[model samples]
Target: MAANFGELFLTILLIVCLTVSSQGREMMEKKYPYLRLASSFSSAKARGYDYIIVGGGTAGCPLAATLSEKYRVLVLERGGSPHGNLNVSYLQNFHISLADTSPKSPSQAFISTDGVINARARVLGGGTCINAGFYSRASPSFVMAKGWNLELVNESYPWVEKQIVQFPELAPWQVALKNGLLEAGVSPFNGYTFDHIYGTKIGGTIFDKNGFRHTAADLLAAGNPKNLRVLLHATVQKIIFNTRSPRPYAVGVLFKDENGRRHKAFLHAGRHSEIILSSGAIGSPQLLLLSGIGPKQDLQRLRVPLVVNNEFVGKGMSDNPMNTIFIPTKGHVEQSLIQSVGITKMGSFIEASNGFGQSSDSIHWHHGISSAEIGQLSTIPPKLRTLEAAQRYAKTKHEIPREAFQGGFILEKIDGPLSRGHLQLINTDIDTNPNITFNYFKHPRDLRRCVYGIRTIEKIINTNQFSNLAEDDSYTINMLLNMSVKANVNFIPKHTNDTVSLEQFCRDTVITIWHYHGGCHVGKVVDRDYRVLGASRLRVVDGSTFATSPGTNPQATVMMMGRYMGLKMLRERLGRRAGV
Candidate 1:
């Protein structure tokens, strides 16, 4: 696995196109002068640090910076560049930020191991570097529902806003998006707004004063303490344990360089090291599995020793259903500035145009109902399911007129019918990317709801308000209607007129976000206190540690978790929050 990854990221040069810059080379060279060629892994094998967090992403970034004020901290992100090369700052710049083919929303745009490709940033700040900068207010009740005191979290949020996630002003963008929809009769209001305080149609992202992407990496750049050191393009491959006692204790991490060369980072738990896995949901789980801390059968099959036999190790994996709706706007909206959530445009209905050819970052508007079936715990869906779905959608026949593409179109894909997937180690090497397969849209009803989502969008768009955009010529609507009837025959997606079955559309746009969860859930790996259930010296703090599924976004949630866990760590370390 180590050897494979070394070759994989050797070039380390992303071949994406952000804008029509005549000279991208000059731009890259000027911006990321610290870029490294694929070389042997450089090692930092010191025997001590106060805290050593693996997978420095959403959670890790904040935790590392904050904790470093009082303790020595080390952050290891498996991907490249910590400061976030200018290219990775904005998502629309994805063409330049990530060269990987896996699209963020739809499954049709990828091949095997494509789920990983759908994600971004192996750099210092993790997903924040590649995310579409949408900030959600923490759901107070939701946090309280998890048995946590929402007050403490609530208290921390404003401080977090000032220092970390800069929730943006959205009225202008909202007004712009909504006013157009209203003029066209597609929306009730002049712009979008949120109902719930936290759920207020989502606000935009935290861009810097100068308008560059404000990522965790950027936050780290400004206020981070000198003690927090970030190791980029580095992967932590193993947890070396002190097995002198019955309960094994973690002592150090084994890492591999880009050349596949192995090195041991000696972290003495008390004097120098406390390990935290902040690699978001996917990366954290894979790190554990690779470290001999997963299911017995998987360990046996892989010829790896089993140090801990936790049945729910990689189970309960989850992510939100992200359905997309693309509406042709009256004017251009900032393609990159993120207005995360907006209400259903008044009369603007959603229609699943399960078409094959389209870009992924188009609008992701509208939510779908999630239906879950807890099949036998062993009935997890395989990678093959997604592959088959993609194949089926790709080989379709359709001829919808161009006029139909003028308005908004919904691409409903994922929802809670969680036929889950798991993380397994290909080998015991930190350099390897996990073998991840999001068995997306595994439930038939889940598929139906996705199609329904699109239909809803179409209905909203065709509202009386949008009558202005409707074609007066019966020829266009009739042609579109005939095409819809024919298109609905075999699979879901695009059908003509306002009268197509959503069931068919479900068969069209099913995809995954590659953000799987539940590998080290509270009940399994960690107890209610977040201490690794059976071990005293080990703990998990990333998204992998989430106990149950939260219905909305998880980036800020992940960061909050890190802050929570860090506070706990701070208390424990000092013997209280202002601990000794």
Candidate 2:
């Protein structure tokens, strides 16, 4: 009887302990629901989701979270999670991620065929994981031009801001940048607002008070965990379509796991099931072309099976062109990213950052000069080539040593570029990077705008507030501009005011601001509702859907679009259920 009682008591105690522990686990799960991995989940087929979102990125993360509120949503990310990545978590390590070329690194660095070096995030948080965490709302003009519902856009902005956006604790360098911008006549300080006003304004950032970055992945905390499944390192290869129906419907997607094992997740046969491609500007269009949804001729050339004959899928690509002016300081400047922006009336935007430690590896002398330009210069007098090569070598040799603390301002042409580019597949293989040509400065106006942008930066640096920080007593505004211009051989000139020389300089020195957009633009590739034209239940919700690039850093606009689309889809689903 004693032994029986002891055993019974022990069993009862074990049950009680488990009950408490289980409750604890439930609480933890709710707190960090995004910690769950795709590998831990059951087979995709067994857990059919109402929505399967490809590219667990800036748009995809928020869209999944919003949809999961009432529907089962699965997010398939091509890269690993950003939850614990120090390179992603810390504000100072911003450029380290951009320069990282590792296969597993969240930032995937790629050089364009046009000889421009840039990066895009492969991690779950998308570009938000690797980019300088500047945040701002889309210009009201941009919203109205795109025909988006203004009220819905306004409502969606707070949904993202409440979770991740914060006003930056401006570092000393950022303060100087702001004062300099105001002094340079980029006036009307709007002060601490997310609105994209045309003036010097202190905007929002994803970095918090502790100097840690809060990414789009953090927005996942708002999701219904029981209904959401996030898969990391899950690269989607193709969109599976049901052609048996009169109109081809995106029924499922075939993706590869981290181990390279293939898996497919299909939509549940519910009233409204969808597969959204928020895979960014490049990835979204690339995936579509691979799935036989692009121009008929291009697909036929690659021998890909025809699914849709959309000629506009991989066209109309645009990226903001950046011209950087490096003002290397002798004193230690506090490390900072974009905080204050100078919006010029001349259709350019100037932004500054400090602590770019060795991140300019992508913008070296040898690599800066395009092969075409090099060839064009090969026939020139060896004297000019030697002088050019020597100048380039000298700049790198000087800058490389100071990369650890050397910080400067970047001036970007946010507007005035009329030229557009295209992205085409090298083959049907998903692993191969697409052929992207921005055709930057193909238009004369773009060159003029770039020159104007450079002149604007010259003015800013000449500001008494900014010039006081400069180390060289002899460094004049023209000298600094000339130094920047000489970085690219094609831009080198006999004199500063030579319009032809400056125009050539603009052509050669232009690089992407990493704000690539369009290719799957509204009215061309997708409709205003974000549904792919001529395809059912297929949609794109990333920057690719933008008719044109927003006049600011596009992170906020991208997130708002995700929130807007997710809510729209939900309303549609509810409406369908009610037989409305």
Overlapping backbone residue pairs in candidate 2 total 0
lDDT of 1 by residue, 354-387 (tens): 1111235543211111100000000112233354
Top lDDT: which candidate number? 2
lDDT of 1 at 365: 19
Candidate 1 stretches greater than 4 Å from native: 1-47, 82-84, 98-117, 164-202, 208-211, 221-224, 269-273, 328-419, 426-452, 464-500, 513-515, 547-551, 575-580
User: What TM-score would you give candidate 2 relative to the actual structure?
Assistant: 0.84
Cα lDDT, all candidates: 0.50, 0.75
Residue 362 miss distance in model 1 (angstroms): 19
Model 2 weakest 10-residue run by lDDT: 365-374
TM-score to true structure, per model:
0.71, 0.84
Per-residue lDDT, model 2, residue 441, is: 77
